[model samples]
Target: NLEYQGAFLYGEITANYDVRNHLFEDIKLRYDDIYKGHTLELGNYKYMDDGAREWDISFKKDKGYIITGSKNYVIKENVPLGSRVELLYLGIIIDIQNATNGVVEFKNDEIKEDRNYQLKIYTPDGKILIKDISTTSNYNQQNKGEVEYDINIREDHESKRNKIDSKVYYGLTDHLTLGMGYLREPELINDEYEYLDKGRLEAVYSNYIYSLPYTFRVGGDKVFNEFEYKVNEKNTKDDYSYDFLGQIDIKKVRLRLEHESKGEFYEDKYKTKFYVRYTPIKALDLEYEREEATKRDGIYGIDYKEKINKYSIEYSKAYKDLLLTGEYEYHTEDKGKYSFNTYYTGLRTATLKLENTWKNDGKDYEVAFSIFSNGNRLFDYNLEARYTEQEKDKFTFRFSTNYNNWFDYEMFVDKKGNQEHKFGIDHITDLRNPTAKIKNMDSSPLKVITFVDKNDNDIYDEGEELIKNVEVQIGEQKINTNENGEAMFYGVPNYVTYDLEPKIKKPNFLLGNNKVQVQGKNTATIVAHIPVKPMLTLTGFINVEDILELNSIDKMRLYEELLVTVKDTNGKVIDRAIPDEQGIFEISGLLPKKYLIEVVYMGIDHQIDGINDEIVKLTYVDVRHVS
Candidate 1:
């Protein structure tokens, strides 16, 4: 018998001896984790059982495999990674695992002598290289010939596959852009390192930010072509897909339309959608959508077509930090007596969502719950909570269930200040079957520390002070340090990367680095430093002698109310101050850098008197005396 719990499998075997004077030898069974690309061998002790014999099976996975018994495995070389291998005895799956490191290992003694043990390795015949398109950053606003490109590189965790993607955007005009993109992946078959390629071309016109703005886009993608290795000829049709999108926005209303067609030459499918939204008030929104789909299937000159239509309406309201939304949709299909689909019947669904957020004691909490009900059956129910303080130092929880068949819960908590804290076992179960329960647990931590760099060095010295109450951020959660100047984030998911940054609130203090990238699974600690520099004071006064020499009444009178402004080398305003009754003004907290000091009086703006030419350098001592 075989049982499944999430991504793991459990199997049991039993045998009985019919004779009282019979003696049995050692019996063994093997099982493997096909998803993780690993295998295991287990053996039972020598025994003679009159009734039945049983063995408890278990597995613990890691980078390497370990077996319970000493049995040598014969490995088949050059099998290739990602190839599915199956171990069969008497035409039944005794064990199955994927090849790792381009080889499959198995022992022949695990199978019965009466049956033939056969191993088979199968490879994919066809695969889709790219199914979605995405871009990066904002469009270029330059007049012409300006180009912006986004590149993405990805490699599988097992290092068996790689993907290289690139997208380019050219500014043909102020409101138009010409775009192209390409994606590459290795072919799934054959021995050589041949790659498959897909490309797209598009023309986009968007002026949505103006008073009367609209947008239109037209694009097409070239599909991948299949090849037949046996005939040594490329076997494919002239396949392609096209898409069109248009949107218009008026004061309180918006309209959008979209259409897409795929497989123009064979097995064609077309879809179209229309949407309208109206928002007459700041708290209320209403929307309506209509979608239609048509599919064609043809083989050996015999063709069949099918059509489906769907309509939906949605209403949402927002009050303070709480949002509520409800949607209802209906679906119908064109049917005939000889049709592949059922006769035209209406199917209805209704979904409701409620979300709320609040803050308490410098911590933020959020709760969102949504449910979808089709006819009288509940389809999905999802509830998520983030950073909700349970007692003192724990948060981040989620709960989801669907059709009463599946349930999932996730939570994470820290144990004191230790970074290596495991979450309590989460019971993912099928409610209809009480015996099926999967318990998943994990423990990992990410800690960030802030310290004062006293000697202006990049390294953290022993005598450097640990600054308390420094803010650190992982994702959107902002955490402050404890008394020890350390902040820890618990329940971080595995196999992901996070960008860590420090939120400094003090001026004239610079961080050593702006952002740091951290990977999950391993305990990560980042040390950050803030170096504070000394400030220079610029003090000056309107020269009485120059005012008297001018002799003009307007010139001398203007000296009484003089304005002084200081700007850095980048022309950013640093400080502004007006002289007191004595015509003496002072600006402090200015860094020791080049600056431009401007003196304005009597509708005239001119450079300060003490500045050399148009710039002033303040390094040591205060810069004084100016008219």
Candidate 2:
């Protein structure tokens, strides 16, 4: 039994019984997860190397004959000692042993005759080395100017007769091929062995014909029988066959047609088939097929005919996390039959299906369900359920089955009657480390330098001081300058533009460059000039005097309310200060330039040198006669 659990995974189990020996042969189990690139297989499976190699030993199927220098097949190469060595056939591990002294050996008794095998050597570096152990060659399609041939010989033990078959094909052109085949078989007739020889010539052409892709094959065969010549004095018979297949694809519609005819000595048969598939919309598809066959019997002078017609439609739609599909098929054969199937899938991992099939002899109804999990903290599993009902005439039968396989189990059997079962558990965890160092080969470094442009030049000078601990922002990364006044940003992608800004917030300092373009693998450089300004402070004293007509309280208030103002050369008030009763005042944060100081009460101005940091002294006299 084979079960396809969808496109991701599938399972198959097969067992054989030998009636003559009254014994049960080995049972095979195989499961494949295409999505994960995993396979588990058991029972009698053949192993072939993923690569190609030459065999050191040969085995013949007749009497299990082993042809080798010794009874054991030994492999000695660059293989490391203690490495695991596995003998496999058709991708199934048959025997496993550890290598000793860089050599691995298998006894002849464990090998089968006339079978292709492979040796899988597990290297120390977690690599598998595949070696072929058979003489089979790989087959590839014939290319232009290429020739391919195959020969086979078979013996009939009961009749003591041998048959030989050979075929050869040559590529006449890229799209055309010519082939020839010959078969010679022995027949036991009247206690004598007679041979019948058959020869055939064929040609195949595949190319576009009138804008439609097509393939056509024409062949003729002749047979020569020694026994027939002895009985009827005529031994040669000729026959011919031809077939044509063509397909056209236009937009969402596909049409295919095939016609074939075979001529024989007693009868001639012809068949033609036509098929079309159309998708009117993305979620709907329609298909139809018609086939007709006719046979003419030369001896009986009778004609027989048969025809088949098929029609099918499929519709599928998806709504968020759920998918629904419906399909119906009708066939015009065997008294006519039709089937309808529906499927519902959720979360892309679980599916439910219902099917109803009607035939002239019986009706079958079935329901199937399956679910798959990719594996988590617990374990991965595949579960399936099926129920079937059949009705024939007045009788009805029902059957139901279920399968739950945890993890994955694959079994294999060898020709030596040895069996091995392998169980696997899949667990996926996010093993990502945030601190892991991943290097980007395409990225380049960015160097940013910050300095005080003392000479007012855009370039950095030797005597100029480099500004240390200056933060620089490049793209989304921020780096601080070292003692060398260099901030380096690593892993900057090449050929991209980024904003390079020196985040300097110091008073009286300015930045020069704010953008940099990185290119190739070269390091990008950004120069930021943080020029400083010479700031100065000025101090002064303001004195106010009033007549003795008022009291001491009024005299103190007049002095305390006095104000002093400092202005630039253009008479724009740059700063102001209020003096205390002691008449002392000061002004700061002025650039190195000339400024004027004035007393607001007296309305008098005085010049003070800002560049030299001179203090001002002002005297204000209030002139009022006791009013």
Candidate 3:
């Protein structure tokens, strides 16, 4: 493409080829010179052996370099005896200067980002020595929106048939979504079929009304079935369906309502449901819901008219971090064997559910069980369990299972980014052949790394140690580092912001950035770094002359005690120190900053007409006296 501005051009070229055997490679090159500084990018993707894959991307601009492939660096420092200096990466301490005496030596294997750092020197007893310093930058992975498609395959041995379902969804905007779905066969497992037996195009719009949320959805669907003996055009059918939903959420109350109408192959049905929830206090919540459904069945077989009404009530309470909920439901249905007639058969059913949720560390866990029975038959029951852990950096991990032999496991790599890779194993209804599944995931999974910045440089040094037991969170999933200081999250979604934060914070450590925007299923990695802060001890004196006494011979000790105030550069008073018996006062553990010190004096009226103050720059320990 050519642009009129300076007659510049911009274009991209992509190529794919098989290197050898089962090995394949893809290359993309982009060029643009519309601005003062021309730009070029070379991206290479390779499918490695044993199903491994990797990507290499390079970008170039103008005369100076923006990013190079990789580099190594080192750091060396002299330290006092009994000083504890540690290098931290991703908030985990990787190296510490444990020597009681001698020069302190530290270095990193790489250069990462550019920023300021707080370097802490601590005493052997864990008291702080010197704390503040400046650092640089390290590498950060950029996340972008991604699109994904999923296909499900199932086979039934009893029926000798197979099923395949494909679905895709993409967001046109934050509130508008579009989707498509297709289901093949009458549970047909064979590949001999050429046509998709059923397909649908769908769209949904969601918006908010102050504290209330609402959504509208509409979709068009079509299905075709051919008799074994003959195929006819009339066998195909198409229809439209829609749904409306609304909800209101407040601190102590919530309400939700939904209505949906559908057109099926044999009949049309409509259903409506509404819920009301109230929280009378912090620890307790009450809720009620009602559902109504009317369906006309038997269009092709034994016909019947059915109407169902259901009502449920629930109570929930919080016991510290644990939450428990119990619910009871009553359902009644009327059915006319042939049509809406005078003689109707009525059925009543009841169900009960109990759920509990709690948290350990920064992760959330939940368990729910339900019992349902119609009349006096054997009761049907199911139990569910879910566990989730999220880090301060937005890395997340989730696990769920049900009594029906169904289970789901998911790991999110970068919760702070717009895109994420998701790895999952889902819905194993048949134990004989568990369906291992992957969604919103490419051939490669997303990576989240934690390391220590030993040199106080923003760059990531090769030898810089990786820290273990550190929690990394992507969105709502959390995982802790193993012995090697690494945690991997899978099944990340695209086109959304996944903020990452550490669940646990170490003392004297400060975080850099807590989140990143990740793009879809494409492999992405985010590194969260926390640097230690430097400490200082500030000593000062407050001297009062008591000038009104004039002839007082002991001027030096005229007023042995006085009050002094310390304010930061922003004029915010952070600390106050008063001299002890020796007229000397000291404050420790203070970070480097400019401070305003003042000597306060008062008369019998407790009012000050004039006072002297001093401003000093403090990085390390220093003595400042005021009168």
Q: Which 10-residue span in candidate 1 carries the lowest summed lDDT? A: 336-345
Measured against the true structure, the TM-scores of the candidates, in listed sequence, are 0.33, 0.36, 0.29
Selected candidate, larger TM-score, 1 vs 2: 2
Q: lDDT tens digits, residues 54-131, model 1?
A: 332223222221233421333242232234455533333333444443345655333211123455544321111111
Go through the candidates in order and give each one's C-alpha lDDT: 0.49, 0.50, 0.44
RMSD, every candidate, angstroms: 23.5, 23.3, 25.3
Q: Could you say which candidate leads in lDDT?
A: 2
lDDT of predicted model 2: 0.50
Residue range 43-160, candidate 2, lDDT tens digits: 3312222222111111111111224661233333223322456665444343455554334666622253224567777643234567776532111124588766555565544455
Can you tell me which runs of candidate 1 are displaced by over 4 Å?
Answer: 1-149, 156-159, 187-194, 208-211, 223-234, 264-266, 280-285, 298-305, 320-323, 332-627
Query: What's model 1's overall lDDT?
Result: 0.49
| Local error of candidate 1 at residue 423 (angstroms) | 7.7
What ordering of candidates by TM-score runs from best to worst? Answer: 2, 1, 3
Better of 2 and 3 by lDDT: 2
